[model samples]
Target: MSGGGAGASRSDARRNRALVLQAARSAFAEGGLVVTLEEIARRAGVGAGTVHRHFPSKERLFAAAVTDRIRLFADTAQDLSDVTEPGEVFFRFFASVARLATENRAVGEALETPELSAAGGAAGAGREFVAAFEVLLRRAQEAGAVRGDVVIEDVRTLLVGCLAMERRRVAAGDTTGVPGRMTALARDALRPGRTVTELPSAPRRRNSVECGVCGAPVAVARTGRPARYCGGACRQKAHRARRARAQGRNADAASAGRQRP
Candidate 1:
C-alpha cells in the first residue's frame, strides 16, 4: 500500500477505536453489560467487525472501559499530590470515586465482576491506580488523618462494598443520594479514631408491605411511585372497593335527604 493510503487507513482505525470506546462507556453506564457489542457498534456508527477488531471479547471491552476510568483517577491523584491537606485530598478523592460510580453504574459493576475475573480482569493499568492511591493513603496516615493500620487493599475492599451498598439502596428504590451518605460513613470509619464505629442501618423500604387487596407483599421498583397492590387484579379490586364505598355513601345521603324536611 502507498504511504499516504497506509496513513489514512491507520487514522480511520484509530477513529473507529475511539468511537467504540466511547460507545462502550455510554452503553455500559446506561444498561450495564447486558448491552451487546452489536448495539455498541450501532451506537458508534461502525460495523460489528470494527468493534470486534478493536475489542475481541465483551470482557476485553469491559476491561478497556474500566482501565480508561482508572487512568483518569490516577491523573486526578497526581493533581492532588501537592495539596496541603492530605486528609482532605484523600477523602475528597474517595467521595469523587463513589459519586462517579453512582452516576455511572458500570463502574460499580466493573468492580464486582465476579464472573469476569478470568477473562475480564482489571487491566494492569490499575497498577498506576494502586500506586497513586498508595501515595494518598500514605500521606493521610502521615498526617494522622486516616487510620495508620489501614492499607490500600482495605481501602479497595471498602470501596467495592460501599458501591455495592449504594446499588442495593438504589435497587430498592431509595431516591435519596445514598452514595453521598455512604461515602461520608466510610470517611468517618477510615479516620484515625479510637474505635471503628458501626454503620447506621439502611433506609427502610416497604418490600414487606402487603398488597392493598391480596395482602401479598408488594414488589417495589427502583424508581417512580410505589405500587400499592401486587398486580392488576389487586389494583382493580382496590379500585372497585373504593368505588363501592363512594356509591354506598351516596345512597345513604339520598335516603337521609328524603326523610329530612
Candidate 2:
C-alpha cells in the first residue's frame, strides 16, 4: 500500500544518511578535506544524490563527521560508566581517549583550519562527555582507586599535556610513542600509593631549518618552539627532488673518477 511505501522511503533515507556519515568519517580521517565527495559516495556504495541530499556540501559533511566523533566519545564514556570495574574503568577510559585523540586526524585538521566548524551537536556531546567523566571520576574516588585530591580539571589538563607531548615526540622523530607513558604517569599520580616510572625531562627543540629546497623562512611558534616547514607536502616533494638530483650527481662523479684512474 501507499502507507507502507512512505514508511519504507523514510527508513531508506535514514539508512543512506548513516552511510554517508560513516564514509565521510573514514575518508576525512584518511585524507582530511582532500578526499573527494565522489570517493565518499563510492566508499559508501551509494549514489552521489544520496550524499548530496544528506550533506549538500563537503564542508558540511566534514563538520558532521566531527560531530559524530564527539558523539562517539560521549557514548563510549556513558557505556563505560555502567561497567562494574569502576576503579579500572576510569584509567581504561582515559587511556583509550588519549589513543583515539592521537589517531583522530579529522579533529586535528578541524582545529588547524580556521574555516572548518563543527556541527551544533558537537557542543552538546562535549558536555555529555564531561558529565559522564565526572561520574567515572567520582566512582573511582569512592572506591579509593584514585587520589582523593585529584579533580576533573586536573585530569583534563593531564590529557591535554599528554597530547602535546605526543606531538613534540613526533616532531623530534622519537617513534616509541608518548601516550602509553603519559597514561602510566598520570595513573601513578592519580592512583592511591602507586609508584611507577620516573617523569622524564622536557622534549628537546628541533633546530629550525631553511626550506632545504627554496631556502624560504620558517615561522617559529610564539612560545619560542621550532616551527615545521609551511606548505609541507609541496616542500617535501621539492626536497625529495633535490636529493634525487644530488644522488645522480654523486653517481656520475664516481664513474668519472674510475675512468680517470
Candidate 3:
C-alpha cells in the first residue's frame, strides 16, 4: 500500500481502539461483565469486527476496561507527589477515588473481586494502584499525619466502608455530595489514634449490673434496691450461701466456748 494509505490506516485503527475502550468502560460500569462485545461495538458506533480485533475475548476487554480505570487512579495519586502536606494530598486523592468508586459501583466491585485476579492486565494494574497508595500512606505516616499503626489495608477497608455508605445514601435518594462527606468522615476515623487515650471514648455500658450469684450480666433495676441478683433463683442461692457461712461461723464459736477451761 502507499505510505499515506498506511499512515491513514494506522490512525483509523487507533481511533477505533479508543472508541471501543471508551464504550466498553461505560458498558461495564453500567451493566458489568454482562455487556456483550456486540453491544459495546454498537455503543461505540463501530462494527463488531473492530472490537474483536482490539480485544479477542470478553475477559480481555473487561480486564482492559478495569485496568485503564486503575491506571487513572494510580496516576492521580502519584501526581500528588509534589504536594507539601502529606495529609492534605492523601485526603484529596482519597476523596477523588471514593467519588469514582461510588459513581461506578462495578469498577470498585471488580477491584475487590477475587475472580478478577486471573484477568489480563487488571490484576497488575490493581497492584500498581495499591503500591501508589502505599507510597502516599507511608508519606503521611512519616509526616505524622497518619497513625503509624495504620497500613494500606486499613485505608482500603475504610475506603470500602465509605463506598458502602455512599451506596446506602444513593439507594435512599440522598446523593448530594455523599461521597465527600463519607471520605471526610473516613479520613478523620483513620487519623493517628492507636491508644485508648488518643481514640474516642467508648460508649458507657448502660444498665449493666452483674448477677449476685452467677456473676452474669443483668439489667439494672430502675426501681427498688439496685438489682443484685438476676432473678429469684439467684437471690435464693445467695441467701443460702450467706446462711451457710453464718451457721458455720456460729458452730465454730460454740465449739470454742465448750473447750474453754
Best TM-score among the predictions, by candidate number: 1
Count clashes in each candidate, considering only residues at least 3 apart in sequence or on different chains.
0, 0, 0
Residue lDDT tens for model 2, 64-131: 88876667777888888877888999998888876676567676465344247445665566667768
Kindly provide the TM-score of model 3 when superposed on the true structure, using C-alpha atoms. 0.62
The better-scoring model by TM-score among 2 and 3 is 3
Model 2 regions more than 4 Å off:
1-19, 31-53, 56-59, 82-84, 107-120, 175-179, 192-261
Q: Please give the RMSD of candidate 2 to the true structure.
A: 20.9
lDDT (CA) per prediction: 0.76, 0.72, 0.76
Report the C-alpha lDDT of model 1 over 102-151, residue by residue, as the tens digit: 77777767655534423333555466666888789867766668764466
- Weakest ten-residue segment in model 3 by summed lDDT: 194-203
Model 1 bad stretches (over 4 Å): 1-7, 114-122, 175-179, 197-261
How accurate locally is residue 251 in candidate 3, as Cα lDDT from 0 to 100? Answer: 100
Which pairs clash inside model 1? none
